[model samples]
Target: MQRRQFVIALTGLFAAHRIAEAAVNPTDPIKIEKLVLSDAEWKKRLAPEAYQVLRHEGTERAGTSPLNAEKRKGYFACAGCDLPLFLSETKYESGTGWPSFYNFIPGRMETKTDFKLILPRTEYHCARCEGHQGHVFDDGPKPTGKRYCNNGVALKFVPA
Candidate 1:
């Protein structure tokens, strides 16, 4: 009973906040400036593999990412628009065969519910370009308890 009430309260609060936010600034999308581009330009900007994942919201093969072995201190950026997505410090070996991060740089990405697989999952994308990055799950490290399962082809690692 308490759990259900708490959930209902949280949902109501979230809806109210979103409504208030829209009333205050309806044009803003998640507080970050949006970037728009032509499909032809996106194809020219990204490689074949990256284009499919970032632009078309496709997933890459698991465990095939060279980024899985990347251990240097740096940040991961969107392959499509070069928007920084995750810092090296937030990354962890989720052992799910993909490069997983505990969190992303705040406001750098946005999320939507994905129903591609029968069960709905949260899908996140680069806020700047709206390029698909990956899905985030609750099973992760202590600090954030989030696993940002990113596609290697959708990201570019930038050393700090």
Candidate 2:
């Protein structure tokens, strides 16, 4: 009985820690000031596909983004707020049919837990606009063992 109580207490502490970490403050260095917009305004400013991906957290079909074949030297910015998120240098072929980057521009993203698939996953969004970009996974190339699997419709490529 004592062992079971200890296990439960430990689990509660871990859950509390996760909750605290997810509650990022606006004043945190990693959190950019937010840009709040009405649904109508967002609809007006973004394309139909971008609106769905950025605002509604919808995923674009894999292998459908021209960015999958993008090879030019440039940066990927959020489709919603044009906030530069990833550099062209960080991109790599993950064979996941989505735009994959190993790293992002510093202080440009915020992460939270997602349970949409009935399991916990780290979901990242643009720090400036809170636009849903994609999920980050542990499998990635050297330098940063993190793959930022982004939805193409949520990004805009800007040539550097």
* Best prediction by TM-score: 2
TM per prediction? 0.79, 0.80
lDDT of 1 by residue, 105-124 (tens): 77788899999998999999
Weakest 10 consecutive residues, lDDT, candidate 2?
19-28
Candidate lDDT scores, in order, read 0.81, 0.83
For all candidates, the clash counts are 0, 0
Enumerate residue pairs that collide in model 2. Answer: none
Q: lDDT at 18 for candidate 1?
A: 50
* Per-residue alpha-carbon lDDT of candidate 2 for residues 60-160, written as tens digits (9 for 90 to 100): 99999999999898788788876678889999999999999999988889999999999999999998779999999999999999999999999888876
